[model samples]
Target: MAQKRDYYEVLGVDKNATEDQIKKAYRTIAIKYHPDRNPGNKEAEEKFKEAAEAYDVLHDPQKRQQYDQFGFSGPGMGGFGDFGASMNMDDIFSMFGDIFGGRAGFGGFGGSGTRGRQQHRGSDLRLKVRLSLDEIAHGVTKKFKVRKDITCSHCHGTGAEAGSSSEQCPTCHGSGVITHTTQSIFGMMQTQGVCPTCGGEGTVIKNKCKHCGGTGVEKGEEVVEIKIPAGVAEGMVVNVPGKGNAGKRKGVNGDIQVFIEEEPNDTFIRDDNDLIYNLLLDFPTAALGGEVEIPTIEGSKLKVKMEPGTQPGKTLRLRGKGLPAVQGYGRGNGDLVVNVSVYVPKTLSREEKSAIEQFRQSDNFKGDAATKHTIFQKFKNYFS
Candidate 1:
């Protein structure tokens, strides 16, 4: 296998970097090389894993110090995990928890490492949760399930059948990476790939475990509790640490990402921490002062007074009626915008025409004759 690149070099960070600085670096690199976007591109995946490994050591205060002084997978505290010694990758990942900010299960392996490593990490999982209008109004907790990876009880995650050790990979001779030379415009260029013999894992379990059949993980269900803060808008996401997949070799579990999905209510729409609802009223009711029932997010109705001769696009203020502060911003309510549409009569029945003719006999429909907007004059009288 080619000589492993320096962790700092891989992450493009100096050895004297601080934890926060290291985290910023890792976050940038991780997002850039995330496998979801690259899709089957081996190079990006390799860089992703490499940056992750560097972050695993450098992000933690203690591990960073140890690596700076000792270099290469240093002692596991009690003189464990000596170089060239067999160490469970899952255990290594878990022990280095301080690095990933409690999100270890999301990390994977098999791109570039020394060679011959044991891996076992439960798979990470994602879930979407929905909140009701009232729930978002007052803030609430949502519980959901996630199907994730767990350790196989039968083999204890060893992947070896009963009291047996794994055999050396014959393809790369226990070297997890293989060198491949190809002719390119830039002359003979050399690259590497994960050894197929051991699946980039230097060793192979000759006697596969009956329980796990060689893979050390098992399938399981994860229950997650998500707290939706008051005023949390739709599409907001909450992070629940260590709730993702159970890592292999007892590695730290991944994080559970709670994406907020809100169901649209017939009566309400949310804008940030505020609520909006449309109020429909008859032409006379809007013209004359009256009280109308409007639904609110509090699971009930509110009687709002409309002023006499209210015009189109008029708004009514409902103080403290909107959603509460999600991150403790401020207690505020949204104003209800009432758009007025004049209801026009389709057809006049004989009796309605006679009644209108009888009313026309009176001076009540006088003014605005030139405009023939006599109906509007009656609208003015409603409030009077």
Candidate 2:
């Protein structure tokens, strides 16, 4: 066997390429060489698998670092062996379903062949799920009901009554396709189409099912539970295989696409994975340092220390206290940015007025000439 090509060369990217760049390159290669697009072409299929393997390694930071440092014989090279000969079509499509807009399968190349008699796979179902900031920070499971077509219990997906079964189509002789010959000016041409008698199903039901009227599916509601991953952004889709509408006449069921919708937080604003929290501090606390307890996304109170004479626009960072990375190897948690705002008193009591008058008259309130001049210049700039 020939030695495998370098991963970066296979993906057509540099060693310093970002994750998005690597993924985009792989997507282009995979789509161009997809088996469905180039049917029965062994070279295209091999190229597709090679691109998948390259993406699998380069998109991960740990694997990319190891590959860079130690080459292919690195310590973490367990699954980085021969690429093309190992994976089947299903494995490749299912693993990278996200790149294809949450859809996976190899059926685009359709004609009169062994696959003709098989029923088409059901259509995929999409629904939105709204999650709170806490739920996004930590993964959560959500349950909801959806109305779709399910296999008929009475017919068992055969579209026939309990005692009888489906009969082979007479028009196409169970091939589900009809061929027609036409005479043109140059020569004779043959065209293929679905059999009118069987409607491409290749079977006819004599005793139709009572519940679904020979369709083999019934209107039903199913409660599906989806386990949402942590750090999923809004509009990201989570696919659940075999949870969608049932296929017609024993075909494969489709997938359930769950779209993420993050609810707006009342106290915190999310920016990517990081969370921003605005903290209001009194004038005394700003002048004299104090400890303030703030709430975290994980339902914990964290005491933050304010420095003396802290500015109103000052930001305090709490590292690794935010959402986790959604895909691949985690890039670690984000930060909780605390933005301080000083609150000024609108009204004061008699005791407060007396104290302010005393402080104004004190010697400590009077500064040197240069300091006063600098203060006056700053005030003038602010007004100007």
Candidate 3:
């Protein structure tokens, strides 16, 4: 296989760039040098393909992180590395997303995030759920039905026959390599290639399984339960490890992602960590000052004291509310802001009109104050 290039450098971005920044960078260059835009131009095509590959990896949180840790020599460095390099122009497979865990990267998301050098892992899956504001306030448990490949119960993850066993390959002497001549940058040199007979798999099964057909796996349906934490917000993703497809070999299963989506609230809007809602107050009550009851995320009433002369759109805060921190810090609580909406009367009864007239007759009324300005008197005398 061909060696790969640094993903961060290929995208022309810093390693610390955020997801949005990565997306913007990729879009700008991808549009400019896109294969469609610059058709038949090999260089532009390469650049466009490279940008797409970068986007594929960078858009997914997990893959970008893995790519970050391993520049060009990581476990999956060569997985989709060829697409970014355009090594194989005629190959267009399913999304790398289809491979890894439903997250698409370059050529394909064919592998998993391995802590150390080991066998491959199955794909990961993503599932989205929408919840009401009240559901987000407290915690909830959700059950999911999923279909994935699982280790064959008959074979028990081994492809060998039940009575017989697997023996190491002999052509490559279990090392799975043979000597061959190849042309390199230096010159024609002798190198080791995979054993043609054994396919370089090292081990060969003497008797294959009849049920799994030597694949060591089968497709099945299963149900999984997820715990939605308190204070979870929309657009946030939760990772459930090792819940994806079973590996063909001894490789591990992938992960499952639960994406939280909040249903639009009729009464409130949520900002990052804060809650905003509207409260209506009558004109008299706003001017005279009074207490009011309001709805809260907790499903209980919150009592608030409205200040005298509280203006429309004025905001008041209630502490210790909002979504919980997903990081388990237990230190984040959002403030709830109540927007004051003064209810103006458009039509009034005779009794209400009489009360207003009597109020206009009080000292608070300013009917003749407009004509009693004294600064104008001094200026008038000077002018006369």
Residue-wise C-alpha lDDT for candidate 3, range 129-231, written one tens digit per residue: 9988778777788889998988888889886668978777777667654555556333453434446666556667888888888878888987988888877
lDDT (tens digit, per residue) of candidate 2 on 271-335: 88889999999978887899999889998999988888776767988999888998784699999
Residue pairs in candidate 3 whose N, alpha carbon or C atoms collide under 3 angstroms: 96-108, 96-109, 97-103, 97-104, 100-109, 100-124, 101-124, 231-323, 231-324
The Cα RMSD of model 2 versus the native structure comes to 14.0
Q: Which runs of model 3 end up more than 4 angstroms from their true locations?
A: 1-118, 170-172, 176-181, 188-201, 328-330, 360-384
Give every collision pair in model 1: 120-248, 121-248, 230-326
Ranking by TM-score: 2, 3, 1
Q: Estimate each model's TM-score.
A: 0.51, 0.65, 0.61
lDDT of each: 0.64, 0.80, 0.69
Candidate 2 Cα deviation (angstroms), residue 347? 1.5
Candidate 1 global lDDT: 0.64
At residue 177, what lDDT does model 1 achieve? 54
Query: Local error of candidate 3 at 255, Å?
Result: 0.7
Q: Which of the predicted structures, 2 or 3, would earn the higher TM-score when compared with the native?
A: 2
Error of 3 at 55 (Å): 25
